[model samples]
Target: MTSAALSVNIWSIPTTTAGTTRFTSKNGHTLDYRIHSGIVGNRWVKDQEAYIVRVGESIYKISWTEPTGTDVSLIVNLGDKLFHGTIFFPRWIMNNPEKTICFQNDHIPLMNSYRDAGPAYPTEVIDEFATITFIRDCGADNDEVINCPASELPADFPANL
Candidate 1:
C-alpha cells in the first residue's frame, strides 16, 4: 500500500526522547505528544509540515495560531478509512481486540465522522492526555473557544470504504 498523506502539526515534536515529539498546526496551534517505537525514520510530512507518529502514549501543548498567517490547519490520516487534515496520524494499522484485529462489515460512526463501510468504525483513540483544549480565531487575532469533533476511521470489508 502507498504511504498515506499526513499534515504534521507543531505540537507533536520530539526534543530529546525516542517516543516523544512536538508539532504545530498551520495556525499557531501547538501540541506535545509522546509514543513508544524503536523506528526513528518512519515519519511522514505533507504540505511542508512535519511530525512523528509512534505506537505509544505522547504529550502535546496545542495552540490555535498559524506560524505564518492568521489561518491554521491540521491534517491526519486514519489508514485506509480516513484522511484528516487537522489531526493527522501518519501511521495506522487495523486493530482487533477480540479477533487478531478489529474488522468492520458495515457503516460505523466515529467521533467527528462516520463510515458507511467497514466492519467497525474508529475515531481519535489517543488516551494519555494532561490537557485537551480547543480554540478558534475568526481573524480578530483573538481565539474563540470551540469544540471540534474527532474524525472517524473504520476497518471495512474487502470493498474500498
Candidate 2:
C-alpha cells in the first residue's frame, strides 16, 4: 500500500485580513500572495506553479519539487533563483474548472502576476466579458497573447477538456 505524504503547510490565513488566502511555506517564506479569493483557472495554472504569499503580491514562475513521497513537486522560475515546495493543489484549483478560474488580463497588473518563460509574458488584457467569451468560444486567436499548450500542462492542472 502507498502511504500518503503529510500535507505541506504552505498556506496560511493572515490575521490582518478577513478572507484573503496567504500561500506560505513552513519556514515562513512566501511564494504567491493574493487578496482575491476563489480558484484560479488552468490556463493560468502554469504561471502559478510553486508560488507563495509575499506581502500582497502573488509571485509566480518560482520553482520547487515535491520534497518527499512520490514525484510531486511545484516549481516556479524566478529570473535569478527558483522557489518551490512540496504541497497539495490549492482548494480552488481542485474544485473549479479551468474555464471558471479564468481571469481578465487587466487583473494581472493589479495583482503583480508574472512569468519568466519568455521576454514577453502571455497575458489576457481584453475586458472580462470578452475574455470569458474568448476562452469559451475561441481559443487564443490574438497575436498579442499566446495561450498555454494543453500538452505542457501539469498533472493536476485542469484538462484540455
* RMSD in angstroms between candidate 2 and the native structure over all alpha carbons: 18.1
Best-fitting candidate, scored by TM-score:
1
How do the residues 1-161 of candidate 2 rate in per-residue lDDT, one tens digit apiece? 11111123223222221222323232222222232233332222222334232321233322343211112233322222233433333333233224223332334442232212112222211111000011111121122122343234456632332
Runs off by more than 4 Å, candidate 2 = 1-42, 45-87, 107-161
Residues 1-161 of candidate 1 have per-residue lDDT tens digits of 22221233322222222233222233322232222121322222112223324321222222232121112233322222212223312122223221211112121223113212223334322322221121222231111211111112123411221
**TM-score of candidate 2 against the unseen true structure:** 0.19
Error of 1 at 72 (Å): 15
Give per-model TM-scores: 0.22, 0.19
